[model samples]
Target: MVHVYGPHIFHTNDAEVWEYVNGFQRFMPYKNQVKTTSRGHVYSLPINLHTINQFFGKTFRPDEARAFLERQADKSITDPSTFEEQALSLVGRDLYEAFFKGYTEKQWGCSPTKLPASILKRLPVRFNYDDNYFFHKFQGMPENGYTDMVGQILDHPNIEVQLATKYRRSDRLDAIHIFYSGPIDGYFDYEDGRLGYRTLDFERFHFDGDYQGCAVMNYGDASAPYTRVTEHKHFSPWEEHQGSVCYREYSRACGPDDIPYYPIRLVEEKALLAHYVARAEREKGVTFVGRLGTYRYLDMDVTIREALDTARHYLPRAAARGHMPSFLEKAIAC
Candidate 1:
């Protein structure tokens, strides 16, 4: 089966979360070794020691590389205000422009200068040769794929899986509580402007054999139309298929029918989100959850982690007949 929404990698530091998933599905050992095509050559991703050495033509020691980066970094910007400034300060101009600038503009459909510097805080810029993508203890893909895992999860008697069901805000519900994972704006019938989101268009094609030889290959140049190419077969290396399926991913502004992939969360969206969040707080019997619900980009682990926390939160309230808050500490973290 294909991951129609694109590759969902499981990586987390939370021990309980790791154990939680393992109980449902057998996870195969997998490490996402990402590569990026910049200019005429390909380089290792997350801009690590190997990437740095390859890009700059230097085999500097750890301390030497750190010192070199310090020199390259823009020391003038003591307090970075934007994503561009933050990246420039972290990896310096040449690396930032080559690896981040064009790619970021393509991904977000805006100048990084307009994005908050906090955006880059989660991004890892290592002085070591670690290219594992995520620096988490547990990282792997479900042996039978996510669809199967989800099917197993919903196997409980009380849960009835509903597809092709449009959830109308006006619909009268009989449920004691609600956990909404749809777009926050849609929940309120878009009284405020629809929050900006980045949706993906995939150019899916089949290849007889290996395609990119890797799971994900990023295109860093603005000249390229798409952000990355994902070869699905490589994701589950434990099993082998002679054939391959690939997707050249293109990101654009989300529309009414399009699935919201990445929330923009720019100045305009943030203001609208603030209003929607305020409305959600006042909303009864509902708790906004997940990426779309919270209007933020979140990994699968974070989303699941929050969902677990939400359940734990709702249990006590359910027993005591108390009010369950709209946003908990975990939800707020999203």
Candidate 2:
């Protein structure tokens, strides 16, 4: 199954949320084992024992490997502030330059020093040989794909689907409450300023045969113009296909016309984001939810969990014709 945008693997530890989505569509077992092409060699991601041994050309045990990395790490960076420092402290200069430095610069359109350490916190450095990308309890892909599952969820008699309509603050709708999932800045017509975001451009092509032999193959070389190459067929391994559909992903600063993917929460953006959040808190008759509305990078399962929580919180108030709160749980930048 090909993703219209890019590959999204649904993995979460929330059992209730997992059971809830399974009601709509069947999910086949899938684990995302990402690969990175660094210095003309392919390596398993998360910087595990396999990668460590291969890179340094040594047979290291778990404890030995951990100690080796400890030695390699820059002990001087006692208080790591930036992502670069964090990586140097964790994997040392060699691994950081190999796997993180170049790819991060390409993806964010900024140096790793400019990014926060929290951005690199998502990546794990393991001692064991486990190649699984995530540590989540439950991981899988929708059998029929995400589109079909979303369609089933939206196939309600009361719900209406509007196409190609732009939202504005001035437009009034006949509804008791509103859940504004659009951009928090856009809702206010960018009155204060636009928050920074990284938008992805996908150059899609069809291959006569298997492409890259993996779902996601990242390029860690700074020389490479693009970030990664995704082969669609590798995503759904249950279904067999002779040909493959692939995409070369390029990440850049999001413009007014581009579709934003990642929220670039740099110092400048955080200052700008604070203004928008304060403005949203004061507004009434609407609630902000999802990644865009809150200006945070959230996984699908967490998004669904929050959506469910928001709905439960809103229903009683809607029934009694009470005033709706702007946000059930607010996002604050620290």
Candidate 3:
């Protein structure tokens, strides 16, 4: 049985997904404002110039901000081997501690020093006043909702969606080809060991008016139990409502029953993943796709792009080969 997750905020860099979503008539565009709560004050995320200026109480122009950050950056860390080291090298001690250290520890359920440097590499520090969370050229959400957009996408005559259906491995054992988007380790039934994952618990509540006055407000303080609170109404600013809904997100280690959100690819988890990959390589007539299938963290856009690429590669080759093609080329490489 497949249990699909609910409502997701789709943010992508892929032009195809961007164009496809834009084709929808009820699309709404809003500049992303991801704020962080640190030291009882809210600051713009991605460490933009405004955040730096506000945090340090200085009016720094672009060049001045760049120079100021350079001064804050630790020159001693010539080679960063961990996420903490990487943050210290890029931003410095104060900003790193206030914004990254506690939040990261809560999110991953581990010290930043134990995580990979690649985790922090994706975050960009801006020298300008731009507070947009993502710098993607095409950035927006559906005006109506993600549910409505997905319903529109699934309105095809050729496609059939069976909701509340539970799919089991035994049921598809004899199938010629199978495209699996579930956890790769789950496919093998966790023979080696269960791969680590960080899951989230969201506490939903209703507010009479604007609660945090933002779409996303992250709690950077380690003392804070929850990681972030997302105001749902702010996501669709085009629509007006008397009341607002928000979710306070708490990150925790994924249990057997919980839905996995972020893949925890620590040293031990990587070893476990390697074993699963080897097993998948030897398996026949099966291909793994998506973040969980490939055991990697992927954003909405990259996931869609990969899905399109996988289909493009498989459909053409499968017919000519007269057999199911191997797993996704990229997944196999990973």
What is the TM-score of each predicted model, taking all chains together?
0.96, 0.97, 0.93
For all candidates in order, the CA lDDT equals 0.88, 0.91, 0.82
Over the stretch 1-334, how does candidate 2's per-residue lDDT look in tens digits?
A: 6787888999999998999999999989998999999999999998899999999999999999999999999999998899999999889999999999999999999999998888898999999999999999999999999999999999999899998999776564665667999888989988888999999999999999998988999999999999999998988999999999999999999999989887998999899988888888888788988889888999999999999998888889788987777877754555
Clashes of 1: 0
Itemize residue pairs with steric clashes in candidate 1: none
Tens digits of lDDT, candidate 1, 1-334:
5777888889999889889999899888999999999998899988889998999999988889999999999999999989999998888999998989989998989999998898889888788998999889999999999989988999999899889997876563777888888888998889767889999999999999998899999999999999999999999997889999999999888898998898888878777888888888887888888888888788888888999999998999999999988777433422
Model 2 whole-model lDDT (C-alpha atoms): 0.91
**TM-score of model number 3:** 0.93
Which candidate model has the greater lDDT, 1 or 3?
Answer: 1
Q: Which one wins by TM-score: 2 or 3?
A: 2
Candidate with the larger TM-score of 1 and 2 = 2
RMSD of each candidate relative to the true structure? 1.6, 1.1, 2.9
lDDT of 3: 0.82
Q: Considering every candidate listed, which one attains the maximal TM-score?
A: 2
Position 262, candidate 3: lDDT: 72
